[model samples]
Target: MSRTSRVLYLIVCASPRARRIGELVGRAQARGWTVCVIPTPQALKFIDRPTLEEQTGFPVRSEYKQWDITNPLPPPDAMLACPATCNTGNKWVYGLADTLALALLTEAIGLGLPLVVAPALNSAQAVYPAFDRSVTALREMGVTVLYGPGVYGPGPPGSGGRPYDWELPLEALQEKVVRPERRK
Candidate 1:
């Protein structure tokens, strides 16, 4: 089947906000994007898979498909991993790809695709030395990290707080990813 060219692969993690990810798909589709949600293994428990599939007209995949089966979606024009956890973020930093989400992230970074990450970690978790270094490493490599004081601030520890704006990832995708390409 011929795939739409402007595809977006949204990697959803296991945050409480994961349930609302259909909001992201709706927003992206309004902007002429075809969104495919790739969920983390544990994220399935948080999100409504059937609803998400209905929303985006695609499956919310969490595992690697068989080798004989061709990939379903088109190459992503951009990638957004929102509400990322400390574990996911740090693993991405260390080149871990045990999951399809991390594998896609690592490969997308290597391909120089437009990439955005919004972490939902609190202050205490953010204090980890690896978290600091991981954010710095990703930033140095041109990754758009929606973290820090005004953005997705390191809130009080164990508060399970979400970021300031749910739309930040979409905004980043528009500003840093889609819009930049339009200029050419």
Candidate 2:
């Protein structure tokens, strides 16, 4: 397979905002990329495996399965952790990878897969000292952390609507993580 056709591993965290994960997955696959959805245990509470599997046309595996490590295939070409929670972000920064999702991310980073994380959390949680430290560490490690849309989806009128612009994260990923091969 060509470079672009190499596998793309997606780590979807469980959160109310995770409803939008499908859109990201669909868009990536439409660009001639293969996507593997590995939802966090918590994320599965919001989005089921079957639904994600149907969308990505591949079985969704959460924990490290018995046969996976032995396959001996190269790591995925790209890794994206969308709707990454404050918990995961904080844990990652401190190098506390207890769960399979986090462990996979740790491995991906170590293997030099193009990695990006789109965080989704409340403003309060976003500003936690741990969160700040984690973000800084990730950036220092050359990990692209896509700025979120700030506020969740649409809110009540006069509710201060969306905080930041969508282009912030879109452009961040487009410029740093995603590099579609130029078409002839």
Candidate 3:
């Protein structure tokens, strides 16, 4: 497939790292993806909407459009939820679609679209049993979850830990999802 034909839905969740989503957008674009930014409602506060909209050339969609209006962004060829929060992950596991971001993610699973999730949370939340279950469940459903010791180690509570390496998700998508699909 040509590079222009690949559309990537980049979901940014409510995390401190969301502030740097523009960097990820640039990287994905350079990698040949036509990117779209889907920010969780709370993520709006962390991100600069105008900057993201300008970067992606599509409005940062946090809410659903009106019934009569069409969605401006094209359908996703793949998706990556970077800095995914525990709340969103757990909600996704249970098939929650309250928010536009979650709605797209839940539907993506059934649509069989390539999906990747890189969760960002503190050590305290990381230890929660539900988080582990959600991660395992998502992986079982064919989602690439970049978590655990080597991928992303959670820091102590209140300690923000080191900045997350956004390249991890991009690389995982290229290697595990996009390339494999292209070969088919």
Each model's lDDT: 0.83, 0.68, 0.87
Ranking by lDDT: 3, 1, 2
- lDDT tens digits, residues 107-134, model 1? 9878888888988777788889999899
Superposed model 3: Cα runs more than 4 Å off: 1-3, 178-184
Per-model TM-score, in order, reads 0.91, 0.77, 0.93
What TM value does model 1 have? Answer: 0.91
Deviation of model 2 at 162, angstroms: 7.6
Worst 10 residues of 3 by lDDT: 175-184
State residue 113's C-alpha deviation in candidate 3, in Å.
0.7
Candidate 1, run of 10 with poorest lDDT:
175-184
Cand. 3 TM to true fold: 0.93
lDDT of 1 at 70: 80
- Tell me the tens digit of each residue's lDDT in model 2 across 41-129: 88787776787788877777777667645532235777778778778988887667777789888887677667777777766676667
Give per-residue lDDT, candidate 3, residue 50: 93
